[model samples]
Target chain A: MDANWIAIAASVLLQSSPLIIAVCGETLSERAGVVNLSLDGSLLLSALAGFVAAYFSSSLLLGFLAAAGVGALMALIVAFGSLALRQSQVAVGFVLTLLGDSLSAFLGQNFTRLPGPWVQRLPIPLLKDIPVLGPIFFNQDLVVYFSLVLVAVTTWWIFHTRPGLELRSAGERPEAAFARGVAVRRLRYWYAVLGGALVGIAGAAYSLDVKIGWAEGHTRGLGWIALAIVIFGGWSPLRGALGVLLFVATRSVISVVLQRSLGESSVVILNALPWLLMLGVLVVVGGRFSEQVLSRLPAALQRPFRGLLRAAPPAALGAELKEG
Target chain B: MSRPAWLPRLWPLLPSFVALLLTSLLLLAFGASPPLAFGAIWEGAFGNQDRLLTTVAFWIPLMLSSLGLLISFRAGLWNIGIEGQFILGAIGASWVALSLQLPAPLQISLQMLAAMAAGALWAGLAGVLKRWGVHEIFGGLALNNLAIILTNYLIAGPWQPPEGGSFRGTAPFHADALLPLVGATRFSVVALGLALLAFGLVVLALRNSAWGLRLKALGRNPRSALLLGVSSRRETLLAMAFCGALAGLGGAVRVLSWFDSLRQSISGGIGYLALMVVILAAFRLLWTPLVAFFFAAVLSGSVVLQLRTQLHSSLGNILTGVLVLLVLLFGNLDSLRAWWAEWRAGRRRS
Candidate 1:
């Protein structure tokens, strides 16, 4: 029973790697005040591009690079359309979402269902010998390790670094950031692209690691889930990673527990769990009413509850930057 | 002295040409002849009376959804959950069709009313969530998925046909429950009339109503509108419910006319397509139906484009998506001019 539990935990962690990467990427972009609403479409296109590149080049690195390029190009369009042309970010992103989906379907016709190169598992020799923790953390492929490291590195860079401060300021108060000579628009452009590149990596991760294969919608609704996690995590990388884990764990538990008890057909309705959870989390943690309820909690419980429940978007998020 | 009178009016349309050019380049990359492919699409959409009627059948639902979107967009709401509203509307209609045995006209009327109410309630849930601090986008997205799941549940569970459970859909409605069609084609004069009436109502409501002014005020500046005694919450809910009602009615029309049963993917991204229609029309009342018709034609034609060229039907989606994006980018002549002048000034500086 214990071994089975360890196996489940390891599988959940493995399942969560791509989502963690995506949530981190979206969190980074949102931190810089741009919502990459094209994620769902971008993921599909990048997954296709990534698989096709890896298939042709026989290199996982090239595949990731290709996917990242696709992601960055899409983000560049969003940034340019919004920043340069003064278009609505939401409008441009939404259009790109549809465009990316169709573009992938149209272009990926030949590549559908084709097998391609995937990342190989590389268990750390000594670390893999350890007890329960080792199997869950160290006995995984490079993609999984990269996701784990990325969460830590992103959290540190966003919270502890000077450039991160500028990025935050660009999202939070661009006028003030501009007053302080932060180069707000430039920071937003770069961060949006960088975040998009990470999202691209997340896309490649799905095709090359987790759900390996090229298909019409290789990563379809997962991108939207990742976007939701960014909000659930309150735009923090560590919290976002935790949110992904929690989400994946719940989904795993549901599939295992509900599949046997309720039979096969009932499993379909259980697909709604994550969406319902998304709505519940938004309602429970996002409102001022939640904050008020938290304030009434016992003193020791209040602190942890506050940290878990604080949900505020960047102040200037999705607002068009105005230059004086 | 500088530009012709038509230039100002016509220049904004440059993006659509650019979009076509870009799509043609994409087709060329695929080693397909652009002219042949476009010709196939034209022939497929207008080849015969049957094809034209088929396109019109598809147009009713698209037109209805687009009209609904006009109200929501006017109030500055995204209504991304319109898909879910459409689904709920379908479920509502299906429930009436499956459970009741009424006269032809009564059955259809009940179905339409139930669909609108279901759609409005689903949209109102999103609006309520927004009031509770959730953005409509996220809430709508969650609701959309839930709506899909609900449809799946109904199809595979209680509403499952007596034979066995399958994801295909519930059983077909009785004859009285179905809309009166034009011979064998799915096109119905009743549905078309309703869609036209909806368009007229939307145009009138947007142009001349006092509520329209309030929506404009709210959309322009929420704080100022509130200060001016315009209730943002009430208006937001009303606009969403109104959009949902129309979208629901469209859903009913879809199941009754275009389809005889409540099937999986009932909305089939029609809600999203309607969004594109509204955006491409630049949210102008006069252009909504025309753009929608154009879209309906392209999509209908895509079936033939795929068969003739051996390309994916999503080619239609690609064309429209690119067009919408380009329009958003360079559609406004003033913005495009400003961007051009800025580029020139920067070049001179360099």
Candidate 2:
């Protein structure tokens, strides 16, 4: 492959790291029957908090921790509001998102364009020397590497462990899970907060690693993209990570094509491409077209095809659970 | 155990009071005097006739958008893409204003119609997706971003002024295409009057019409409404399209009367603010305009807050968010009370 192609592949991985983390986080939350719709605002506020903490302390670790803390707090509010107050999760999340956006813009004004600490690249020794896969996967910053590990770890945790079964039961049939000795509400709160913290780490990754600066609306619109990916991923961690990669790849390709074929004016069109593509993906995935195609397959192939094409959301998702 | 009528009347206002108190504390934390900031906000919003007129100008679009959202909310749909619809409306109106050479009134009316069509078409896309099982919220959000990008492309690309590309927006519309301002203020009385007319029409339709009842029924329980012979597909499309038209009309009024050009942030987050207004009004058509006006005042006041205190104007957004959240939490006080009572009774039995 050409060096340019190799570089593009690496860049795609780098760009997708934060999104991958965020997608996993949202997938985990949604799988546990909670929807943290405050992803966008949470990202902005955490991005700001991460940048400021890193700048003041000169420690990237502290920045990531601060970002995660902020993320968890926002998630905790959504969980508390929905679980305890019996408020609509969507409403509470939406309000927090707007509030977080404005608060971040207001608070981060001073930190805009300021130099801050960033994550350093930590390439694995043996893996970095491999010909094709090495540069794309193993050679990156700590966050990028961690994001890959997160995909595998999250996939394993969600599908392989005993707690994973409990989580699924909590989301799919909360009353049944409660009868089976599960604390559905408490489990929801834990996963939502945990998922939110991961999302916060994604934000910090944007500031302290990927984009690497503090700016107003710095992480703008990314949270929404993450939310869409969670859906596209069918609320599964591995699939969600793949969805992020696909989105990032599309974005990269669009930018490259725009640079090659069009002037700066057409950049607007390029900017619209990701959203349009996501819309198309959503329509295809959620629409009847897929179902029609699935039915046309042989009966032997039909079940697997349906499984791959249709990933239904958890049955008890978004519903309030009452104690017996 | 009957509640006093006066207490019920005052109950809805509690959330606003709590939000304001909390926001005041936020101001204090920022080292600004809450009283001084609020005083400035009040003065800036309605202290003078000129400011009051400006507030009205802002209120028109907000009211229109809120009314649009009210329609969709009543139909069990969340039209989060109202911002996109609003932008498309501006684009549609701007196209008409720029391309058409008609008499002023005829041109303005045509522009509004074009805008409404554009908005309906945009929102209809989301409706179609929703009909196909795509969630309206996600579809709307994607469409919203696409619409913004489309608007930005138009303003900075083909619609770029003859002087070349600039983000300042297209050249001001022809003088004839512009709405006549009320006195020296930017406020257009005709636009305000039309908005009120729209509001009145919505109120009438929602209250007395069979269509309104069907929509309310659809929202209350889709399965039951469907069993009752309300066509979900048709009603969903109609509700979304009508809401889009209302939001489109808002965009038309905004472009023609105030800004007089297309810009990227022309919607000015009014779509989201309108959502908050609808929530605050509890979907009551009667209170939408009042809530919208209150929000507009806060927005206008925030501009003054920025000028005087060097505080960011987004403080108003923060205030709005706080207010809506508080209302969402406290709005269910009656239900919470009942739940608590039931819990205590159960505990007593145990």
Candidate 3:
């Protein structure tokens, strides 16, 4: 209820949004059985690309759009490896991370410390005026709001819509989906690209907000956290966003606490706090739930959905569109 | 399709080498001669006794850490968090070396024991999680991050030096506890050599021992291994423990040798590079040292690359990336076969 707490809470919400967006985007990727561990690299590339594009064009949309383009391109390479070449999904994911990190660093070399076009916050007047919960809920950058909408939309699509059903089917049982006339491979490609775009948007959110600065390892391990969040969410969008909220909020809390308690000597050591917690979550919950869920979860998460390999997807997912 | 008797194996390596070569082409764009740069890489690695000693010094920890990696991977487990394990090991050893004022030999032995124990504990936690249900990838990665943070906390807080200035690291290591560096090299020789000899034992154990066969069985097929009364989880814990111990040895060497001064980034990307080394060597322990030395050369020489060219340190990483990807892609010559078949068909049509 305090004024200062309100501001901090609002910032926390804003910070969490990018994580949610990245996690949701990665959800689509992993749900389709293609774990793009390259989220860190892709997010970094897009973050750099977004900042650079926004910086040059002085257009926020252009920057975010360019970020999406970069993400999709990176995703395409992963797709080329997994879908076309039938490589190990994890290996491809790993390769993409290495490639993506370097490429982002190389291309973003010019944009270091460049002033980026700040994404403006779109606060509803009445809502922004309210105290406490008002600013936290109502006032925010466009991407923060977009991320919330994306969560709802993604959940709805995956659970309610026909296309969503198809994608789910492809992810759960590609062969079954294939038998039912769904173009599983093509579906995977689009899902990965779209998912990548979302990740890119998340990266853009970082440049637009969240310390709109650039450097090597700029995005740090947000991408990997996104992957972990997806699993923590149990392949669900709403849960994924919550996980991100938890992740980013804990991160913000760590920063504040470290600032208050930890002396100068503690800074370097304290920097590892939030990440340690994230890993702790995985070791504790992520560890136990993995066996239980993996036993019942999609059998084809890592293995390619080879039509010849006879891997069956969930019923009704990716039913053939029957195009001429 | 074969060009020579040994072509299959030799051919498999060609793609990765080419990939590394092409990545160097990127250095040329930065105004460095690719061949000349490679020459520097060679010199930095093994051009002479001095260079070789330095490279070996660098090679010791890397070899120790990567052999640990190979131990896990050979059993079909991936412990990318060896970096974290390595950090924990260093801390463990540092705790013994710095905190306890025991006799020289006893201090060293206790430090080694504690270091290995700490690594085992950290990695074993991951193994427990993996067995409990989390996959190795997620569990190991999370453990890696946690270990790093914890290490940072320890080194920055209790172990922090009094006159901490620019660089944030632990206090100076006691000279007695420092791993004996052989020759005029900056790298740790005795520590690494001892570690390498242990690696030989591990290699022998993995290839010829019953435990090794069981692990291979687990890697090749979990159900079958389980059917044979081999507990995959137990094997995973044992292998992970071994891996952690090896990484811990590296960490101790790091503390005693090059980084007698503490560092947050001591393990650096060595854990990740060890992953790549495991990939390059295809899970062979002996090959780990060779491949890791090659990478260490690139890492050490990359400073020179920065001196000579406009390229970033990322070039070395990118080269390693391309190599890892290429090796995995071309493993068993699948791509080359597809390419060769296409070429032959085109030739017949012509």
Evaluating just chain A, the predictions reach TM-scores of 0.95, 0.97, 0.85
- Tell me, by lDDT, which candidate is best: 1
Could you tell me which 10 consecutive residues in candidate 3 chain A have the lowest summed lDDT?
A305-314
TM-score of 2: 0.96
Off by over 4 Å in 2: A296-301, B1-9, B338-350
User: Candidate 1 vs candidate 2: which has greater DockQ?
Assistant: 1
lDDT per residue for candidate 3 within A143-168, as digits (tens), equals 77888899999999888999988878
lDDT for position A126 in model 3? 92
> Model 3's lDDT to the true fold?
0.76
**Whole-model Cα lDDT per candidate?**
0.89, 0.88, 0.76
Which runs of model 1 end up more than 4 angstroms from their true locations?
A: A262-265, A295-304, B1-5, B165-167, B344-350
Ordering by TM-score: 1, 2, 3
Ranking by DockQ: 1, 2, 3
Interface RMSD of each: 1.5, 1.5, 3.3
Task: Judge candidate 1 against the unseen true structure and give its global Cα lDDT, from 0 to 1.
Answer: 0.89
lDDT of 2 by residue, A11-97 (tens): 899999999998999888988999999999999999999999999999889999999999999999899888877888988898889
